[model samples]
Every structure is written in C-alpha cells, then in structure tokens.
Target: MPLYQNREFTTLMTLKNSRLRIFLASCILLLGACASNDELDSQANAAEQQIYSEAQKYLRSKNYDMAIKALQQLESRYPFGKYAEQAQLEIIYAHYGAYEPEAAIEAANRFIRLHPQHPSIDYAFYMKGLAAYSGNSNIFSRFLPTSESSRDTKHIEEAFTEFAQLLARFPESEYGADARARMVHLRNLLARHEIDVANYYFRRGAYLAAVNRGRYVIENYQGSTAMADALAVMAHGYLLLDMPELAQTSIDTLKVNYPDHPSLSDSGEFDVAQVDEADQSWINKVSLGLFDPPQPPQFNYEP
Candidate 1:
C-alpha cells in the first residue's frame, strides 16, 4: 500500500471513532436526565403519601390541629392526586373536631362547591349543619335561668335549613334519622321562642303584637307544648284590645284543649292578674343572690 493512502485510512478511522464517542456520550446524558425526573417524581409521591398518612395518624389520636396542618400540606403539594379531594374533606372534619365551627363551615362549603358530584357530599352537608348547631349554643344556656327559646336563633335556623336540604336530597342518608330528630327539636324550640316573644309583648302593654305572635305559634306550631300558653296569651291579648269575639274564640279553644291551664278560671273568663301573680312567685325569685331572679318559665298577661 502507498504511505499516503495508509495515513488517510488512519485519519478516517480516527474521525469515525471520535464521532461514535460523542454520540454515546449524548445518549448517556439523555438517559441520565430521564432517570433524574423519575426519581424526583417518586420522591414527590412519597412525600405526599407520607403527609397524608401523618394526617390520618393525627386524626386518630385526636390531634386535630396537627391533622389540619398535615392535610393542608398534602393538598397543596398534590392538588391533582387521588388523595387531594379526600384530604380536603378531612380538613373539614378536622376543623369540626377542633371546635372551629366557622372554619369547618368554610371548608365544607368549599368541598361542596369544588366537588358537587362527589359521593360523600352528604357528609359535607351533615357536618355543616352540625357545625352551625354547635355554634348556636353557649355555656350560659346550661347555667343561667335564660330560656333557649328566648335567645337568638339565627344559627339554629341556618342549621335547620342545612339539615332540611340534606334530607330532601338524600332521603336514605345515614344521617337522616339524627337530622330529623334535630329538626323536631328545632321546631319545638322555635315555637317556644314565639311564645316567649308573645309573652314579652303581653307584659309591655303591646296587646296587638302579643296576639300576632300567639297566633303565629298556633298557626305554625299547633302540636307544640307551647300552644296552650300561646292560646292563653291570644285570649288575654284580645280581651285587652276590646275584641270580645276573638277573645271568646281563643278562650273556647283553650278550654277544649287545655282545661287545666293555669291561665284559665272556673268561669272560663280571662283571669290575667291571677296568672301574673303566679308567674312572680317567690320560688322563682330566689336565685341565691348569684343572678337576677330566674324569670318564671311562663309569662302572665297584666291586662
């Protein structure tokens, strides 16, 4: 072979080898990049799963604040994962367990808005109602002479509405029976509240207002225990307003339904003063000097 040809052949081989090395290096770098991404994804998934598990553990131990934090982290980190919605629901439960009613309501509302078709939506509604119900009560209800029916019922009304929605939408829900029971209690409470307000009006020389409130109770809550007292208030209010016909009608209804009611006399005429003195009895006035005399449970007309 000629020397120049031999040298040219060696040069060609060297160039081919150099190109092969560069191609192999490029392939290795590309493979390394893919592997790195997979590793990062696996790490992210692990972190999310770990956080969710931690939240569950916190919940089981009743550490609601910790559970809320862990759940929030999981949701923020894995917003599109299968566990994201579940975590959001858990946050609501955690808020409820922690006695954070407003936060629980907000979270429940958010869940309902975001996943209207979710299967566990009933749970959200139940929790929302439960939160409202709890929020309506205070420590004073148990200790004071104050009547619950006479207090503000805004939260109770809100709760009743929520429970009603739940029952209407999901008749066979697991929470249906409990919600129904609460509704019954709430209805009674509202009826009694109307009676309380009517009694107040009757005491303040507002006969017409008292009659309206009493009539409302009769029309809206005919079966309630407060109906007897409501009828008495109506009869007395009508008598004071010089409406004998309406007063006679109320007296007749009261006699038929509540023959033993204290507001009535043997003659069946409205005896307003006797009922008033009984309401101011000394037994209810002895509050042991701790608070104002316990207001009598029943109100008596002063007309």
Candidate 2:
C-alpha cells in the first residue's frame, strides 16, 4: 500500500510541475510579442517625426509645394501619429504661402471645423482673412493712383467681415491688432468710394442721387477723411436740387468742420467746381497737375 501510494503522488507532482512550466513559457512569449509590437510602434513614430521635420524644412525654405506634398504624405501614412494634426495645420500655411488663396481658405475652414478647440484656431481665422484680403488686391492699383477702396467694394466688405469675426471672437489673438488696422482702412475705403460715387452724380447732374450718396458717407462712415468732401457734395447737390435750407445747413456744417477746405469759396460756400476751374491753367492742364483728376466712372479706393 505504501509503495504504490508514494509512486502515484510523485507522478502527480511531476505532471503539475510540467504544466506550470508550459504556462510560464506561454506568458513569456506573449510578453515578448507585446514588446516587439511596442518597439515597432516607437520606430514608426520616430519615422513619422523625421518626415514631419523634413516637411518643416521645406516650409522654412519657402518651398510651399514640396512642403505640401511631404505634409500630405506624413498625414496619410500616420493619421493618428503625434504630428498628424500639426501636419494638417502646416498644410494650411503652405497653401497660404503658395498664393493658393482659395485652397488656403478651404484648408483653414476645414481646420476650424475639425479642431474647433485647438489652441491655434485663431491663426486659422487670421489666415482665412489674410487670404481673402490678398485675393482682392489689384496689381494695377499697386502702381496707379487709383483708389483700391472704390474699385470692388464687395471683396473688401467680405474681408472686413472675416476680420471682424476674428476680432470679435479672439480679441486677444496675436492678429487682432492687424485686423483692427485693416478694418479701419476698409471703412475709409468704403467711405471714399461712396463720396466718389457722389461726385459722379454731381458731374452727371443727378443732384438728389449725389445728396443721397453724401448722406450715406455721413451715416455709415462717420469718422472718415471724406466727411468734408461729403458735406461739400451734399451742399452743392442740395443747392442744385433747389433745396435752399438743406444746402445752407450742409454749408454751415462743412464750414464748422473743415474751415480751410479747398472746396469752400471765400464766402464759405460750397464751390468745388470753381476751385477746380481756377486750378486748371494751360500748363497745369498739359502737365495734368493743375487740379485733382476728376473721379472716373470706375474708380478704386486704395487702402
């Protein structure tokens, strides 16, 4: 009884030990597999970072097209990597630098929609406005004395609205100051454009239309440099339209606001045409400097 029982117990203990060894080996193999996968992931991350760095170099060198390609590759290859979101942001910058304004605007809008809470979202907004602003610039106006503001007020108004949104939403953004400055210039441009339209009406003998344009300048652009000219236009236009009291009121206001204006006569009456004619001499006419040029039918307002 004692011999059989001892042999059976020894066999059972040996089998249990054999099973434990197999279990430990399986655990070790599983851990090794996990470690290999982790290492591969790390290597992949480093490669992604290197690609992102190369893209940054392209951006620094102002090779926007190359940068865009590299960034696109990095994003596609490592969509969930550490640099994926950053690559997206840099793509927008690259589009902007490449003078692809529509693309830049589209990218910026995509970023804003996808990453609304991103810390650098204000930059996207700023870029959007800047792209719109540059897109509206006329090359001819850069050299000509034409007013940019008066040319195409539509794009200018859209850009101003974008900037306004940026300023309103991110008052403390790095771009806020610049946006504000642009907004001021836009306001003046719009005002001057309106006044130019008023002058056109005056020259065409549309007195009431001219007066309405001047009133638009006064109401919509209160602090513009064109206010003095607007008052002159209103006074002259009212007088032409047989509105004596309104003309007198505009004349009085113009005198109070701009006593030394060139459009005013010695008696403080609105007399722009007289002043214009007086300044136009033979030499001045030939030289084209005798007086300010008349407002063209299609004038631009340069900011």
Candidate 3:
C-alpha cells in the first residue's frame, strides 16, 4: 500500500503488450551481454541481488538494525547500481520501524534532495513529512514549555511543506491520497496551535500580547469558529486598554462575524468579574462604549 510498492505493482501489471515484449527483449539482451562479460562481474551483480533480497527479508522480519546495516552495505558496495533507489527507500523504513523518527526524516529528506527528479520523489517527500509529523507529541501541548518528548514544530511544518510539494509537483502520484489527508491534519494542527497561544496571552491579561496572538489566529485560520473567538478577544483586549478606535474596529467584528456569540455581562474587558465591586466601579469609568464616552476620570497614583 505504500506509494513506492504501489508504483512497482502498477508498473508490472499495467505494461502494454508491446512494452512488455520490449522489456522481455531487453532482459534477454542483458542476459546475453552478462554471459559475455567477465565472469567476476556477473558474479558480483548476482551477489548484489542477494544483498537486496536479504535486506528485504530483514525488513519483513522487523529486524530494522540488520536491515539498515544491509542497506548501508548495499549503498557502500554499489552506490550507482540498480539497487540504490530501493536501498534508499528501505533505509527510511528501517529507521522509522526502529522508532528513530528524526533519523528517518533525515534519511527520507536526503533521498528526496539527492533524487529530486526521480519518479519516486513523491514517495520520498511524503515519507519525510510523515517522519517529522510523527515526531510531534500532539497539537495541544504548545502552551507548555518544550520538553524531552517535544519536537520543534519547525520540523513538522517542513514535513507538511514537503508533502504539499509532493502533491503539487506529482499531481498523478499515488502519494497524493494519503498525503492530502496528512496535509489536512497538519493544517488543522497549525490553526489549533495559533488558538492555543492566543488564549494563553488572552488569559494573562497582556492586551498587546493577546491582540497579536488574536490577529494571528484571524489571519491564518480564516472561517473557523476559532476565528470568531479570536476577533472577539482582539476587541475585548483593545477595550480593556482604553483604545476606543481599535475597540470600535472590533465591535463590527463582534456584531457581523459572530452575531450569535453569547455576551457575558462581565464586558468591562479586564478581569472585571474577578475584581471587587469598588474596583469594578473604577474600571467602568475607563471602559469604552460601556461608559458614556465623556472625558474619562483623571486620577493620580496616591501614595
């Protein structure tokens, strides 16, 4: 079911009759040429096929270390031989199967970069993206500090970007179906990450921070419910900072973007619900639209 194998199977099954005959003739010619070649060269070519077979057997047994070693040996022994491409693909599997996602990503990326024009480039890109994406712990953990299990999302984004490239550059590739699915998941994760950071700054009462985060969500996330919340939060943060012009801009967003959003009565914007009644009365004086829009109270910080 992997993109590489699918391509091989299709190549074998769907060859036109003329093409199949041509392929058979080519194989006969190669065999005749090999018979006439130096005996040592023929033996070495047969040994190369055996090495490939042994590597595939190890892969089938899930003996990833042995498989990796076998493939690496194959590369060292016959760098430009017929098995090099297959060796590259198996190396990715060997690393991935051994829970070495970062290593798998690097290997997959190298294959794609080195063989950009190869027919299997789509599979290489897709596998690279999968390697990086699989390294991430999850989408929700963005609010927390980086941890041992955390992978830099920069890697994940690169994977997604590669997968998208695979989709675009190889429109007829077998990689497209699953790569498209992964692309959707990655896009949603990026959007969710934006919302999580926005909510973090919003809850900390850092209006400027909240506004920047909120704007990121809106500009990036587009038509989701999260976009509506982001717009509302931007407005609320502006209001709390006593920026009426910016707050007015958010007012239209609140009304037109999400008319059905419930209005919580604690609209004074800055943690008014958590403040004492006397403190509430003071904040109401500066809160825009909620106040009469007259000259705000002038007060000095008293010692």
| Predicted structure with the largest lDDT when compared to the true one | 1
The whole-model C-alpha lDDT of candidate 3 against the native structure comes to 0.65
Model 3, span 1-303: residue lDDT tens: 799999988877777766989999999999988877868786888888889889878987989899999999999999988888778876887887666778887887788778878766666676776666656644344334433112345755876787888788888887678677666656555655554555566567777887786788688767544555566667667877899789778767666655544432334233323222221221111112210111111222222
Task: Give the TM-score of each candidate.
Answer: 0.73, 0.73, 0.58
Q: CA lDDT of each candidate?
A: 0.77, 0.75, 0.65
> In model 3, which residue pairs have backbone atoms overlapping below 3 Å?
none
* Residue 255 displacement (Å), model 3: 7.8
Give the residue spans of candidate 2 off by over 4 A.
1-32, 138-146, 242-245, 265-269, 274-303
Tens-digit lDDT track of model 2 for 123-182: 788777767765665445434664464477776787788889999999998778877877
Better of 2 and 3 by lDDT: 2
Worst 10 residues of 2 by lDDT: 278-287
Q: Count the backbone clashes (under 3 Å) in each candidate.
A: 0, 10, 0
Q: Per-residue CA lDDT of candidate 1, range 39-125, in tens?
A: 998898778778878998998898989999998989888999767888888888888777778998999899999999987788888
